[model samples]
Target: MNGARGKRRFLLALCALAALLFGALGVWQVELPCQTLDLIERVDARVHAPSGPIPPRSSWPRINAKSDEYRHVLVRGRFLHDRETLVDALTERGAGFWVITPLRAAEGPILINRGFVPRGRASPSSREAGQVAGEVTVTGLLRLTEPGGRFLRPNDPAGNRWYSRDVAAIARARGLPGAAPFFIDADASANPGGLPVGGLTSYRLRKRLLDVALVIMTSPVTVPLTILGALLVRITMGAPVLFVQSRTGVSGQPFRMYKLRTMRPLAPSEALQATSAGDVRITRVGAWLRRFRIDELPQLLNVLKADMS
Candidate 1:
């Protein structure tokens, strides 16, 4: 009788633990939207706060996404129209490109996302009127560098194809001296021609909610499985159980795509070939992971990071 009573108590405790665990998970998932909304509100507050002078060159080292991103700032400089680079973008008006022009500020050159232009009006000549020359004051929100290429397509400097507005890369490609570490998104003030529409930002709540749902539902199952898989991969294959590659995201933006390493490290030349069923390059554990689609579980993190859905 005592043994049976003890068994019942053990079962009840197990059930209670599971209920608590699942309940916690559900609460966390539900709070995601609220957390995101709060963040957006904070950013909006910063953006609307009284404009301040652009951070000087000496302060560049300390500036980061947390401290400076989306902060409204004032800058006066000459626009380097000749060196402007167009980054692929998608906005409410449909597919377009951001005209990124460098502003020759006193402290240093600062890249400015002048505005968005539809595919038809991408060329400078097409939107010549809005291309203001000479020194001008620009007040807008500062944005951090978006390094790497979007999705599967990496930034191709040689071809002049850029997906993300990577400040360092753009400065290097444009041969600009003393370029600032960040860029500025121009405000909604009307330009001469209205070709490159300023002050356009993209946010899709429905898509974000859907992505959150996917991460929440799959994480409980995938998290532990991924950990076990990592251990197995390490034992069978060696260290470095994961691999990260740059891939394009929404609106041709670039983001890092994460995945479990599924094959032996290969030479640059050998890595180009597609894997066959009997290929020796793939490790035994990698083969199993690929077969069961277990290798893709880590991408749930990318979804959480808003890089993928």
Candidate 2:
């Protein structure tokens, strides 16, 4: 009787533990949407406001990311493209570099993220047609300076390989001592030759959070299915259970989409070619996953971070 009672207690304890975990998870999940909505409301108001003069130098010290970032502003200045820094960036077009140029204005010099340019077009001479010489009025969203590099990697100014747009670091390196602490992302206006593409930043973050919440709330079922499918792919396909490729999203923006690995990696020349009905690269297991629509399971995580609804 004691043994049976102990067994019953053990099962009850296990059930209680699971209930506790689920309760905690539910609370966190519920709070995330609320936080996301609050963030969107605050930022959307600032973004939709009319373009105004940039914060004066006196307010520079008080500038911060919380309230000031993403504010629309206008600056009239001459772009000093010669000292422009090309920071590595990954956009809808593909992996490329951002053209960070300093604009000489009356208030002071400020960095302007001109836009994304592929490696071949990164050279200033390549896009000389778009380089406006005289004082031009530029309007866009302001962004806080990124410091300490990205993803635990430090900015290598010595080698001219910058990972983040650290305002102070970039200014000191470019010899612009009084450069503004913030930079502006140029609007999606087409340049003469359309070399560096602008206006890639998405403001639809509200939809993004809801989309992610949808994915997370279904985690109990999706997570297990994903793990099972991944294991099956790994076992059948040797290695590389996931395939990543760049695809265009809403508003003609490029984003990397994810899916279960169902085929071999394509060669550079063959990348433009699409997979057909009887493509040899698609493995037997991959075909089954595709038939059951299991290959798309990985895309749910994309909704979590890629601002794709």
Candidate 3:
């Protein structure tokens, strides 16, 4: 009888442990969205408007990070047609190649991303299509030049395949001289057909700061409170206590972001849509999750996993 009692206790303990873990998972999922929102709010405040005379090469924001270097700068130089780097680039506006060319500015040879040209127009010959020539005044944010290459794929200098904006690598590859430490995002200028353009730089510090703030809020304390809330919802309801969906992150990368299950599952293979307050699909529990941001806690795990990139 004692042995049987002990066995029962062991099984109960195991069940309790399982319950604890799932409860924690659910809560963590809920807290993430709120945290991320906060982070982004904070980063947006300071990321734009430039940060003084631009930090030296060492202090510039690293690859995939922000830097104050892009503060307003003025440079007047002639475009050096000989060496140009066509980089694979995607912008808030669209996807295309950035025409990064050396400009023989009086200050030095600063790299310039002339603008976005579609796939067909990525070649130097495209410069003839509508090139900005002569001693032009270029004014815009100075983004710290990306060096080395992109994650995973190393830059191939031989065949002229570049994944990132590593200025040093480009200089080495093209055997160019006096390359500036940074690159300028040229401001919008007049062009024909009113398309395939440059100088459409939009500055928004408010949005970026919010993103950074949200990410930071997903720290330890807030995550626990979220888990407690998930436990209450689960005990009152039944199965399907969590919801997961895929989202596109930086660099067009996709990852599954979790939330408290807020909507009714459609046909098993159905696609998800953005949730609206008035949508009939949202459950009472899900509505609460959305309101208090209990549904977004799972993304903390994603951030920890480095999946946000």
Candidate with best TM-score: 2
What C-alpha lDDT do the candidate models reach, one value each?
0.81, 0.80, 0.63
Cα misplacement distance, residue 97 of candidate 2 (Å): 1.3
**What is the C-alpha lDDT profile of model 2 across 1-309, one tens digit per residue?**
999998688667756765676677678667865776676677778777888999999999999878798898999999998889988776668778988999999989999998889988888888889887888988888999989676535799998988888989999999998999999988788877886787765433345545765876686667656666776786577578888887765423466788899876667986777889988888898898898888998888777765256
User: Which is the winner by lDDT between candidate 1 and candidate 3?
Assistant: 1
How does model 1 fare in lDDT? 0.81
Runs with alpha carbons beyond 4 Å of true place in candidate 3: 1-68, 127-129, 191-196, 200-207, 213-250, 254-295, 300-309
lDDT (C-alpha) at residue 131 in model 1: 85
Candidate achieving higher TM-score, 2 or 3: 2
Candidate 3 lDDT, tens digit per residue, 1-309? 999998688667756866787677678667866666654543444335443343344443352334344455567788786788888765665667777778886556778777777777676665474555677776666767677766565678888987777888887777766666678776576444332366644432333443444555544555565666566456545456666777765544466776666666656555456656588877677777778887777666665554552
Lowest lDDT block of 10, candidate 1: 201-210
Best by lDDT: 1
Worst ten in a row by lDDT for model 2? 201-210
Task: Please rank every candidate by lDDT, starting with the best.
Answer: 1, 2, 3
- Candidate 3, residue 201: Cα displacement in angstroms equals 4.7
TM-score (all chains, Cα) for each model: 0.63, 0.66, 0.57
lDDT of 1 by residue, 28-65 (tens): 66786567666566676777798899888899989987
Q: What is the lDDT of residue 142 in candidate 2?
A: 91
Better candidate number, 1 or 3, judged by TM-score: 1
